[model samples]
Target: MNNTTQNKPINGNSLIEIGYPENEILGIALKINKKRTGFTKAEMLDKYAQVMSSPQDFTEDKIFKSLAEAFINGIHLPKIDEEIIPLNENPKEFKIYGIEKIEDGALNQMKIAMQLPVTVAGALMPDAHQGYGLPIGGVLATKNAIIPYGVGVDIGCRMALSIYDLPASHYFEHHDILKETLMKNTKFGAGHGFHGKYKAEHHVLDDSKFETNSFINNLKDKAWSQLGSSGGGNHFVEFGLIDFKEDDKKLNIKKGSYLALLTHSGSRGFGATIAGHYTKIAKDICKLPYNAKNLAYLDLDSEAGQEYWLAMNLAGEYASACHEIIHQKITKELGAEVLAKIENHHNFAWKEIYNNEEVIVHRKGATPASKDVMGIIPGSMTAPGFLVRGNGEENSINSASHGAGRQMSRTQAIKSLSQNKINDYLNDFGITLIGSGKDEAPMAYKDIHEVMNAQQDLVDVVATFTPKMVRMADDGSKED
Candidate 1:
């Protein structure tokens, strides 16, 4: 016996070289290796030859019976088909607003998303920027499938505005008191929450849905702790001034400038946990190509999908609760009366009617601009945010930009911008900054005016709110 042949063990490759079908190679090699563990490669080869020569003799043998029968009958093992959902050959046509201002990467992401077999329609807003799965400011409508990434990690992240009856000059008249109230009343940054006397209360924590699943049940305590707290990364609690150039019937306020409180936050740790858990389940069940894996979706009829839907809605409600509590607390502290309130969730999913058919609409970093719907679109810390009324444009899937959108990446902003420059902008705009990093500098965002101009058909600006005092997480946290 040759030494090389004696030492070399039989493997699938060797079986393939011996004219065995690719599908049967694994079974044949495994059977040979298990039944003849101590036998050398030469002995194995000899046995294989014997089996091929007189396959009937080994028909009764447990391990060799199938191998012999397969050889005698010249039959190949059945191949298991991989369950892969391919991209649509003919992708649905999607609309893009402000194409010139949008980066190519974001536009490319939108194009790729439109190619999804589940995707029915999509639209890219003026604020579109590169993000995971769907780009920020990307609105996608799908048929009976929900993509977790499309809803974003910070599920139900939204903007809340409370306009007070006091004049805009009230912010400056009591700047010190107002700034102190924001710092003391709000909690920012990750994992930072109110304790003891500061812990807030909300009715969302009492919902029976929290008891439905172990995953959600465990989040109740965390939700309670962070009930009225604001999370980091573009989340802020600010004192601002809202100017209504003309009388607005919706708010019923006279034409004038009024003091207001604006907040940006979400369900905090609760929503994040739900998103992470369900996104993993979606990826496991929904097998897709490498490029589209992140966009994996869960069938709405499946158990997992139902659970996610419930959990997502609960998180959205919890987020709204956080804002409500924050407003209640601050209003009580300041002894100010709220004249009007406007709020909307950007990162969420809604079952809406499009083309006379029901579809799940996922707005990732985008706002629902359905007809007469009220939403907020914030600018940079120094720029002015807007209160807008939706026009319900069918081409945009009734959506608009969520914010001015990042003109530069956080890393790029940190590398290119300086604290001195940020200070100059704030000073020039008569804005006071409490705690924030250079990454959130005003220069890092697109011009809000230009963004609004580009989406004239999508929404109508009702009023403008200019930040007077801004407070963000001191810790450099990533945007939700």
Candidate 2:
């Protein structure tokens, strides 16, 4: 009588046909109108049609799925604090050294990191460059939480320098043995490991954490397999010469050139898997504002936070073991005695006192420069690395740049650099590079001298290292 055929509404049969349970439909109804209850099929259909025609409706299918998911996940009305906090109109102040040298994108990422609700303080190292979430050389102090990406994909990525009693000439005299040792003792590239009887042996495999933590326990075999290998992308195992200054007390060696084995690596696949797994969980639990998308944090008191803490610390130990095995194997293969070892983990989190309060300090690509702390900061293949002692300045958060940070991205390097030019540059430096790609060429990095000068207040250089022979991953693959 009133063109009723044209005015038919959505029926319960339609909802059933679409596979929504009654409770899901009811939840959607309540979401549309909290007072909605005790509705007949016809009444529900009328309300659905009314809401669908209103401005609130955009996609009917999405609304249905969201309502269904809410029921499945037990999500009801959001709690009072569920809303994302507004971007800090006034981010807490932080320190930045070598500001002029830092890229704008890196600066922006640091600013975003400063806006995180848990961030207590922040600092940018001289080697600052853009990376995922946190800038490469940025340091952040947070309250009772840790950002996984803040520690980086290569968890416990570090620099290890082992000074030997042998003179620098030993490397040149027995170059063949050094070459064979490097080739035999270390495996580079992603997912590559020793076969049969050649696997590295380390005590890190005996840690109880591997048995206790499921995430870490799952990675035990892989971790064991990659124990002594140098995972790629800026990671390297090199034979170098260290010239100690007379005033250097930490090394306490004669002020002359000596053969040193310098290695740059991390926790290998074990770290990468842990980072990826936990970061996703952090995102699910913490609804961060758009600005802090992948920079989410897990509360320290929460179960996940504790688990990650255990895994991360274990990974740090494993990384140290990796360096230990590499250095030990190489030194043993050459029959060289070690004089001193200087090592530090850059990609890690530490429980430290900051501003008279305990905080978790995350250094992505920055070194911990707590007063008199020794760390190794490497340069490009053709450049020099440094053995430095931390000055423990408060403003810079007792941190220094990890290395002469990349001046250009890998894509830029691969696109711009010529293989012939890279070869010529290596030849000029008299450096024999093995198994490296164009992306890690000398031109891709900043001048190490300038970077050291910029962070003079953060650390004091104790010795200088010159790379004589270096090995990295082969080309045509991404290692990190």
Candidate 3:
């Protein structure tokens, strides 16, 4: 059985990959292989090391007679290994609003998230992965205003689909040239160069109202300079089709061959500036009952809030423009026309109505799922991803999980999984990938199928694309 359960469930421990900290990580006993469930993050971290047969060494923290009771009582872990030690740790209980199921690690993250100064309501997408402030796959609804941390620094980072009319065979025809273009023409890793895809300045969108100040002036130039570039990490450009081969039957590939350029990114540094700028502003004000970390409440009538909204929308447009540039460059080489395109903005908040009342929707790693709100959910390098349309599920506040959440951390993936395995996996898929760091290996993420099923009511599947080759650019080592 897989960690992701769609039509055919696969194995979680094997096929499903993760990167948890060694010695710190807790998994079901090796002999048992599969268990119905596992322990919560707190319990695992607190007690699993002692008397536990696990990956990490156990001699770190000895659980003595004088240990805290809460840690001792919180051990409802899966019964697998040769020894079954019942614990009595009292975990900090979290109230599940809409998400009924959550993993131990995700719950721990949620515990931190709940403590964030401002919290509207959050839905833990099944594929929840740990993120900076809020967890990925986290759908948060704010009260009257919004939280920058909840929305995240990567404003409008999203996925763009470029469907080409070229056939799959044609891709192979110019494979070498394509690879060359991806290599010398594109940059990956930390310190990526734009390779001169466009002018060295980002054009300000007409729809926004931010002034032509220094920050905006600098951002505009830098954004345009990065046109057609795929920043490092999980961001990528893959060549794939929308066909599925379940059994001998094939359906809905739209005949012929199509090349899809899919990537996950944002408005670059401009968005980060906005997030940082507004975060400080909100924090400086500190008028909310919540802490500064949760600082927020953007009055539509206020200049600051309105300016941020305008800048945010402009950044979103810039991101779309970046994708368009990439799509155009890729298609120019192939000599094909774009059949259709789709995109969605994540990492930003929007004022939307639910039950006729308007509230701010802050989605960090989430996509808008408001009935026909088109978006894409990308998987790790090794998994298949989905393109979906929102169905307006009110319970979820019209949102869906972003991607397969991370099952393991970067540290763990590097230690337990090998580079050889990564090479072999890519070889089997006939895909050549570049720029994924220790954090972005395929094994580090959760099961996307499980995540999608859990939020079925939030979106309707429009199409599916299996990645072939992915190109991610490096943004240098400047903490990008």
Candidate 4:
């Protein structure tokens, strides 16, 4: 008898060679391997061949039924030209703050998004800029639908600030030590993470959602590897001086300049994977016009929609854990105690009641400025950032700008700016730069003061943070 067990196992490549389409390869290969675990390579190939030859005969076989059906009917993939759903003839009206500052491209995108059948209401923030589907600072509310692109790829991207008991003078005295501490404790750039003894741990890795589906399950290892690490492209960790004009009872600290730590990051590779997977699924299911395809949404009651929701929230929790670990590690290293901490995230969706009806509100790159909510809005590396409280402006969807939005694209900044220009700006502010590209030069972003001024009705400035030393992803890496 032939020893078929010695032959190589049938795999995705093998299926492709036998005329099986690319899209159906994964599902078919997985099912065959899983259901016929004990079968030899020869036996596996013979079974598949038998099913392909007489698919109708195997309709009653539980293991081969789906495969036979698939063979009978060709697999269908989404086509870009197809319009499964038509655009709304009358787009809903949306409020725009600081219209003079926003680019026409961004405004047009917001208009297109409002035309989606699922959209109920929308808003454009003062710092708005053109993004993939919705503008960067766009807030869109949909009825029983969730738009993946409206939430952006960097899910739960946010800011965190920690106030220490040390005086601002401490930064002047131990500037070198502080810089070294940041370099040693933090890992920047895409795919960069701690290894061996330095690897970070967090309870988010234990979340049951990781086991929810094959796609998410495959990402658990990546989440574990990148835990506590900050990814690049506008993301940074800095030592700063915080000045509170007045004593705040909520923070339990007196008004004065104090040493603080501020970090900007998100869920790293974990969120990117989740977004890519679900966004594709959303696009395939809810086809729209070529211009509005990115705004494709998933009905909340569907299984795919539920999976995306779970994955999105898990990313949010993971992002918070990353900030916690960063603060904990650096403070432990310096032997300092944190007196007050504040954090908030954007690029997320929320279920909120609007006009007595529930809707899914997506804030792509806007902060939730609901009444009395606290959030941080950072400027460029050389500019001062602000701490603010929300005013709950209903017309603007209770949101505020996330940052001094980029005035120039990364390519434009790199081509137009120079290292000398970046150095001069940092010198003027007495700020030290560790590792950053010209793409993130201070001049690349809009004036933070102007952005804040434009949204006076949306938020109240509570404090200001001046950067002392900053670290970002080095050159040649994309932002997260």
Candidate 5:
């Protein structure tokens, strides 16, 4: 029998007949030991034979209930020398795409996350790589719970693309102006914030959610200060050419090529603080099994859970606002009007219904792909990114990989990859770099084409983007 399967309540009395709100100890014990919380009367009697025969309480009901609570909470169960059994139940096996390409470390992390009692279902994308709790391309659904580490450190990290009315050739003709716009409008790298003339303003700063929770309120000043800046690591902003050999409603563009700007970033320091604060809270309260410690969860009905939901959504808005500011400022400066845009977040959670049951779906480094929903999956700076629409496959948790998920860690790239080789590779791909580090070299990632191919059923490529000019963090700096 699947341990995660919902059990029927005893005569509609949840924790009541066995001592509900009146019995605080029993409630805590039930919460700590999830398996034996609502056992049927017959099963209860059979499982606690010693407790049922105890004479101290005289009544079977009183004696068995007390012993059950004590047994679950690791306290003395009267004079019974009984050993509590562990919940050795397996969660639903995760459906993985491109399993052969995924690393063993990432697969191990996925197994641990699946062991979490809250996990309802899980999926691993082709771009899977080891991350905090869930792998970078892992998707997880939990029952009335949310995992902070599963959402990862960079909350609301996303990709946005704005297509322009100008032809692809226009970028080269006005290269200097486009370059100047990027330089003057956006700041990149770690701790890069709006200063002097580059400071940006957005309506997200006025959101009430910021003050709804102390965590968001405390991050307001910092969030406002860095409104338009892009965080470091693989985060970037670039000019590229989007190709569509056939007309599509998703893009609403003719069968031709056009100039586009793509930006990848998150909620900056604001997100990091919220993640750090709530992750600690989750870890402190939920004492999960050893392998599942990083996968600690908070019940949706809890105060912290509600607060985190608000904070996470607010961070998404902040991230979108940052993208808007970057695109608006750069486009306006370049005198280029927006034709159309595509945007989607990869690092976030949503209240989704899967298997006809409501669950909190967390996509760490994955994109939500609800049937026909549009999203962006980027590759390395030099490789191609895809404009896709979700196929809404249930097994995949309606998601796709966020990018050409890292094939190598930052430390590995920095050590083995030389600047000259990176430059040569970029030049070979006709990618012009404005600012970047060797750590983000194209070699550091898996082939974008292969990743897209692996998840073909999850998403359909509507268009492809080839980077012409890219900007990212410079060498020898801390990652975001």
Candidate 6:
């Protein structure tokens, strides 16, 4: 399988985390043909079931745990080094600048990264948290090839910003009725979408892409249905107040401040499933047993790769549609008009010229802070977020932080903060509060100020926003 793929399947610099031994796992897994592989899917399933039936899987878990430590960079392993979170994740050779936590899973990912290499330079932004393979707040740059998993299953998953003319106080005046209307018009959590709500027009085919397949055909339905829905986990939409009135004394626009609505989500499960399917194809084609499973990628020039690129872009469009649907819902309930909306996807790949090389730039939790790039910089529910533009700082590859980095994990947030505290914070803003489980409370993330300060070399802030009523998945619903 690897023979048919590009010759350059390995990346030395990116292989650091999966260095030495972890590639063996991929080698072994690939050697066993899916049909003849000793650990067939059936056998693997049986093993998983037995392990679940008792605790045998714990042994594999422990083995994987140890192997993960060896492979993943910025990961914490039991028998590994002391409690030191580096100011820069890859201090040597790589330019990653921050490492807030290095847990076991992250280590495992490093071990897995040995074979699949990334060209996109990374900074491991302060909000770094574990996701499929790439860390939630992690950043990466790649050349020639684009890793599907790096952008994640939720291709084009990102944050959105909508500015408003009304002040935060205006929401308070319409409180109860607005909340009722929002709930009725908008739906949150999994499987939340409006079936057949949009009109899908076929785009003229790009040069390398092929005719639409059944899978692609189904996507049309998915998009229409998933419109206006907010997927579970950390995905959310909030009404916030910008506190930037001349030296922080203003609540009005004279302070260059504005009331904003902020939200975080992705292309929903439709994108996730497509990403998963192709990621597997990339892995199988690579056949070399990469150190990081999620680092699977496709060359931009190949037929399959072109198909993925087209699909990925389409998914981004769908994600934007989802947000637009939400904005409409909010407008209907609040009876307000939107001043402007600035939306960008931090996940997904871009075609750009880096170092005079025409390359595909895959930004995984990082926004392109190119000289003209305009994007949002969101904070926690109670902190300040911003809308910034890139000054074309090459050191950070013209990229900036995604949001206020996370200081604590979801479990930690739930343990440390109380419901009353959450309630108090929301009340102080006098904004409508809605769905958000304890996992995504404001305390779960890091301070936005420090994160921005550390990244001053990357981008310039155009505006800052403070939270009014931040809504996320509620305590009673599914949390990711």
Best by TM-score: 4
Where does the lowest 10-residue lDDT sum fall in candidate 4? 49-58
Superposed model 2: Cα runs more than 4 Å off: 1-85
TM-score of each: 0.83, 0.82, 0.71, 0.84, 0.81, 0.72
In what order do the candidates fall by lDDT, top score first?
4, 1, 2, 5, 6, 3
lDDT of 1 at 262: 94
Candidates' RMSD to native: 17.3, 14.8, 14.7, 11.6, 16.3, 10.8
The reply for model 1, stretches above 4 Å from the true place, is 1-82
After best superposition, candidate 6 residue 20: deviation in angstroms? 27
State the number of backbone clashes in model 1: 0
Off by over 4 Å in 6: 1-92, 99-120, 195-211, 243-257, 288-290, 332-335, 412-432, 475-480
Q: Give the winner by TM-score: 1 or 5.
A: 1
Per-residue lDDT for 112-231 in model 3, tens only? 555443344556666665554456666666556656556765567888887676666656777776676555444433223253433433444443344534555545544554554555
TM-score pick, better of 2 and 6: 2
lDDT tens digits by residue: candidate 4, 1-480: 135632456676545432344577347755766767555553454355435433444555667778877755644344656757889987899999888889998899999999998898999998898877788999999999998778877789989999999999999999889988998889887656655677788888899998889878877876887899887778999999999999988878898999999999998877876775677678778888767866879999999899999999999999999999999989988888888899999989999988789999999989999999999999988899998999999989889999999888766787789889789878998989989898789998998989998999999988899988999988434543
Global lDDT for candidate 4? 0.82
Model 2 TM-score (2 dp): 0.82
Q: Which parts of model 3 are misplaced by more than 4 Å? A: 1-120, 189-214, 244-257, 287-298, 474-480
Clashes by residue pair, model 1: none
The ten-residue window of minimal lDDT in model 2 covers: 50-59
Ten contiguous residues with the weakest lDDT in model 5: 50-59
lDDT by residue for model 5 (1-480), tens: 122432432331323322222234434434433455555432332222222111122222332455544433434222234332222376669998888779998898898888777788999999998765677899999999988878876789988999998899998898888777777777875545765565677889999998886546866877887898887678889999999979986556888899999999998767765775677577656766545655778888999888988888998999999999999888887777787888999779999999999999999999999999999999888888999999999989999998888887665787789899888888898787877776688998999888988999999888889888888867333332
Candidate 4: C-alpha RMSD to true structure equals 11.6
Q: What local lDDT score does residue 355 receive in model 3, on the 0 to 100 scale?
A: 58
Report the Cα lDDT for residue 333, model 1. Answer: 88
* Candidate 1: tens digits of C-alpha lDDT, residues 408-459: 8766777788888788878999888888888788898999999999999999
lDDT over C-alpha atoms for residue 228 of model 3:
48
Q: Which pairs of residues collide in model 5?
A: none
